[model samples]
Target: MIAETRIALKNAGKYKPEDISTYIDLGGYKNAEKALKSKPEDIINWIDEAKLRGRGGAGFSTGQKKRFTNEAICDKCLQKYVICNADEGEPGTFKDRIIMEMDPHLLIEGMLIAAYAIGATKAYIYIRGEYTQSISKLHIALKQAKEKGFLGKNIFNTGFFLDIEIKLGAGSYLCGEELTLLESLEGKRGYPRIKPPFPAEKGLFGMPTLINNVETFAHIPYIIEHGVEHYRSIGTENTPGTKIFTISGDVKKAGYYETSLGVTLRELIYDLAGGIKQDKKFKAAILGGAAGTFVDHTVLDTPMGYDLLKERGAVLGSGAIMVLADDRSIFEMTYSILDFFKHESCGKCVPCRVGTTQLLLLMNQAKHTKSDRIELLNKLLAEAEYMDQTSLCPLGQSPILPLKSIKQYFESQF
Candidate 1:
């Protein structure tokens, strides 16, 4: 059975918008109810106690970000913003989409908890342009939340005022980055920024802002209501809470499945995904997403989490695993993944912009001429290795992870 997410995503898809009173009846706003009664420091303490880490691709700790943003808010700024990043643009990661569609209310409750802890009265959930259904669902839920006592002035009669707005994107994958996301929110073209002035310090139009993934927000309500100890029992010591996996390709049951962290990749594909169809032999798996690590059968038993994947030379990422079996051409996979990075580079940096285009050209040439294949492999893998670590942003870097790992594991197939 799938283990339920208690802290962040408890009320998603289970309740309607007009049912805020019913949600309150069913213990929906209990966390906020309690937070309103307790000190702001206590709310921060609770999240730290829960060990609630960010489920966005970055996996930064929410408690840590909150602690930083709360501290960074200037004495002059009157408007602090808590932002929910709903732009789920990773190629194979659709788990965030599922939670946004199913449980927007839980997200709102989480927002309330965040606003209370950080002294923010305004929040926005920026969704992708492609997610028409999820955007509509968020709009409906936000409107209902305003009508109920859960949102607006004096929430639950506590004199705390919070309002949430929904914003739509033009569908750029780079906007998934926190800085680029803030840029887009301000009606500018999305371009990632340099660190040392990370979003926690100066974000969302030069004000203190906190941006978290949809899955990260969905987890908040459960953590606040159930407390941290119960939530910590589900996953690893450092990586607590159930994770939503979006597994695709060469699998029978390709969809969203929420399971505890540290669950084996074998269990995900073989048990949860029902294994390969028509008895096809297993070849490899793409742990994370298109821009993530490649795991051959040799590493299939590795547990899923943050530190574990890092040990296996991967980052676990947003938990979007793509299974690949025999008969698929490694050359084709390499070309396709490179092509995607080439198109999505945003041209903000030369290494990624020029490098991806060159890789694509070399891939095209390699496809036709067998002699150029080895040369292309060396050039692409070597350059990609350099780019992954040295690029201006994670986008430029991760585009080559799949290509390099594929070349390393399945050299014969290419």
Candidate 2:
């Protein structure tokens, strides 16, 4: 029997989301007090040992990202920044939205700890403009945090000051990308920036910046409260802690469910989510959001871990589990996903700008044309691979995921 873990979602559904007193009653911001007292290096080392990877699809080491900004040699620039990528624009991923709306204080507390760790005086929560409720909740939380001395100058008399503000994004999918988020925050068009200098080195007006998504920031307080061993004991060795999966489509109960990293797909679909909707046979599930790969029932028992999914050419992108019933057509699903990517692609680089459109065209052809469908699919696969290699940001590289999955698992559908 697979069980649900609620470390990140601990306060979710348990209290009045907008009320800071409810959050305080539940021991919120306790970690921030503890984190403020400890040395930043100690906190970084503890996170590194815990192996808490980023929850915003990439699964990169969170501790390493913090260390980079904390250790960045930017003597010339005294200003540093921390950004919470609360865009949550990924198609089937709404976990971040839940965290923001339900447990706003958790996110604020996490950001406070993160800003202190990197000595960042200013922080911004770059949320999507469409998430008006979430924005309102965060605004209330931030104000309450500041009023309680959790934010602002000389917090807790530690002389480590931080100020957090909210920046609304204009609902661009590309803005979910860190560089593009920075660009949008800077009042420029949301364009993916070049990589030789990552956000850690030079970000947010040429100052060292630490940016993580809402879910990633939500995990900081838990790690700070319980030692690394406590977190490691819940999930696999390499991928520790619980993850909030936003389950949708063809499921009896399709919402956010928090579980350990190693939970199998079968358990998620059957025990936790109350089986497929109307007891239909499970066909496939997209492991992550739109940029994630599809998996069949043959791998239902496979453990959901970062390294394990990578071996299968899939990603735990944003922890989105979009299930497909036997009645669903793989071709239609592929077409819709491709269409979204094509529509959302920012026309900055040739690979993403043109490649996504080309992939969408081929998908259209595959869906409508009966003649030479296999040839079109073959060409589509090649185009997706080319885009993966040449694209500027992750948005362009996403085509390869569904394209490869369809070719490998559902080629007969074509």
Q: Which digits, one per residue and each the tens of the lDDT, describe model 1 over residues 324-405?
A: 8886677787778888888888888888888888889888877777665666778888888778777788778886677667
* Worst lDDT 10-window in candidate 1: 1-10
320-401 per-residue lDDT for model 2 (tens digits): 9999999998878888888999999999999989998888877776665676766777898899999999999988888898
Off by over 4 Å in 1: 1-13, 17-22, 372-374
Task: Write out the backbone clash pairs for model 2.
Answer: none
Best by TM-score: 2
CA lDDT of every candidate: 0.80, 0.89
Provide TM-scores for the models. Answer: 0.94, 0.98
lDDT score for residue 413 of model 1: 66
Model 2 poorest ten-residue lDDT run: 365-374
